[model samples]
Target: MKVEIHNVFKNMRYKFFQTEDGIYYIVEIKPSFWKTLFPFLYWFFPFPVYKVEDEKTIEGIQTPESWSFDKSSAVLATGGVAVFIATIFRGKIEMFKTELPLYIKIIFLIVMIFCVFLIRLFVNKVKFHDLYKHVNLKQLERFEIKVKPQSFKHIGQMFASYIFFLFFSVMSYIMFFLDGNVFVLIGGAAMLIMFSLVVNITVKEGLTKIEFIK
Candidate 1:
């Protein structure tokens, strides 16, 4: 889908325009409902969704690629969860080297494509923990900004990712034996997030960072 950035407000939230087959879609990406309620949740799991202008229902499912941020985030979080399990079982593997199931292999291939595409298009659009040069700061005072820098596509992507990961987990039963290797699960997740971050730095232009890949 071709999109033209229509407006960008402080904290990097606003509306963007997409024209497909002569139909105009205004996509809004902002703080999620949960984030709005909890405020602090945005720091750990900021869920964003996409919505059509004047529409109440979220259509994040229509364009799943835009939601790659959620996919990456979910992968990392799942790895962390697996790590905790492995630690409990006293397993010592930093990475999982088991054979991949056919369906899982297919999903993983798609994940690879998403990873590459993300670095090219979506990751560059994210602005988490952004530093403003011109904004003056007082000595020893904490710099604060209310709005977080985020792409309009984030919210939808968030939900889409959750559904996919849940399916993957259920199908494999987390690979049955993964319940044992604490190091492998955690290491695998760390590697995945690290690779995504590296791609963000290599493919994404301008300043490089290792924050939210939205």
Candidate 2:
């Protein structure tokens, strides 16, 4: 089969053209982390899997293939937000039974802040603009930019940032109201580490693919 591949990282749509068959297929590859984690979760949980062929298909497909997160970065950001929220609520619930201390809360806040900083750095490094120039398409292939993302799309990035910040804020308030508990501090620290690692891996994968294009 005569094939042409276009790396559309910014659009999150990889276009594939086949000349011999005179057919084109748009294969959507998940971001590296999503690719890695989701299958693992599926293996253990045995849940249904969903994928989007294109932006339009994302809205209409019903059943298993209908629902999907935007991309790998989006999945990571959502995970970060969940971790932040879960940590705060869990801590608050525990506080009613036992009081936590201040020093521990301060430490947790510091670690969460550091994790958020690392996530921001990762997000900056994964800019879609950098990938625009590197995309390769064959001369004879008929392809269209299917997933055009807006410039202001990055604003949603603040959701991840603010989630971490809110986690810190909650910890601070809890420290003032009650003592800092070891379990909450440890849970927050664990979440921070996980977030940092996930963001690092996601950004690294995007950079690696872009480098391959260059």
Candidate 3:
């Protein structure tokens, strides 16, 4: 009887464990109890998980920061459009049964304006030349930029500036006009709840979508 020992290599698709010196029995080294619960503990605990993509993979990925100027410029443009939309929506406050308090309305306006200001700041930081400077631009003519699940919370926070401006503005409209209509409030809230459900579902699954500029 002959026993052989093989050293593992990096290119191996799956790793195997060996047991006993005389018999090289291939074994699946199962995780300990603590290891099995690691995912749950890691999720609930504050300890951060850093997924390190290899240099090759990282170099291939094109995040929003690496996106073309034309595509990147649109964020600020959308922010601008949001400002106009907010102004237009506020124009009809008289239609509401009772308007939001003057101070409260002022706060909302300030927040929306602040969101636009922050977006402008973000845009200014983007180097438009990056559109052409990236060596992989030929391959990245169109590439998807993914937000990892772990980072979705931060991405949501980034989105909240705009969402607050938009969602709250809609709520303001509801408060103004729908105050008298019970059905409308209930229906509007139901719609909001459905929208929230969709957002959470997408976040939990993490977003991965191809990129296209038009």
Candidate 4:
């Protein structure tokens, strides 16, 4: 398979391809900036995007190389759910002291975990259309492509994280209003570190796995 570059938006574009094995490879093109910066900031970015423009040939060999794991999808969904739940409950806990019942906190955490698991399962099952239609006899002849999209999953996760941080910031302010406790400041800093680590690890692992598959 041969890949041709198309137009890009914010570093993302479509890839045109024709497989020698009679399969059509419609892939998303990665933005050059994103790809270059991915190694440093993989956690904040979303899954790349690719599209199928046309098919040149149709060979019938199932190629494993053409089918790569969508780890970014899973990470985004799971992370987003986590951040959302944390932000929501943290806000509630801060606003209404009476609402911070132990049972409620436990229930909220359970729900968040369940949501993350569901998102992970959903991402695992995602598959690109016509992904395996382009495997040729020679492994070297296979076409590999990449794309970067402003993924909703990624954006949602990032937004959720932002909310979580905002919640902490608000808590810090509340603490200052009450008695100027330093613990709130420390807690806010801790949250930032934890969130950054999670994002960085998830993105790096996801992208690494995808590249290995390709």
lDDT of 2: 0.39
Error of 1 at 115 (Å): 22
Worst 10 residues of 1 by lDDT: 199-208
Stretches off by above 4 angstroms in model 2 are: 1-101, 127-179, 182-214
Candidate 4 per-residue C-alpha lDDT over 1-214 given as tens digits, one digit per residue, 9 for 90 to 100: 1223222111111223333454444333222333332323443334443333333322222223555558899899989997997877674554433334455544644554355445433432332223333422223234443223235665566556656755765566455335433344445445533333233212211222222124
Q: Rate the local accuracy (lDDT) of all candidates.
A: 0.36, 0.39, 0.34, 0.39
Which sequence of candidate numbers ranks them by TM-score, best first?
A: 4, 2, 3, 1
Give each model a TM-score: 0.23, 0.27, 0.25, 0.27
**lDDT per residue (tens digit) for residues 99-211 in model 2:** 43656556656766676566645654553233323322232233322221112332244335536644754564455345445455455555544443332222211111110
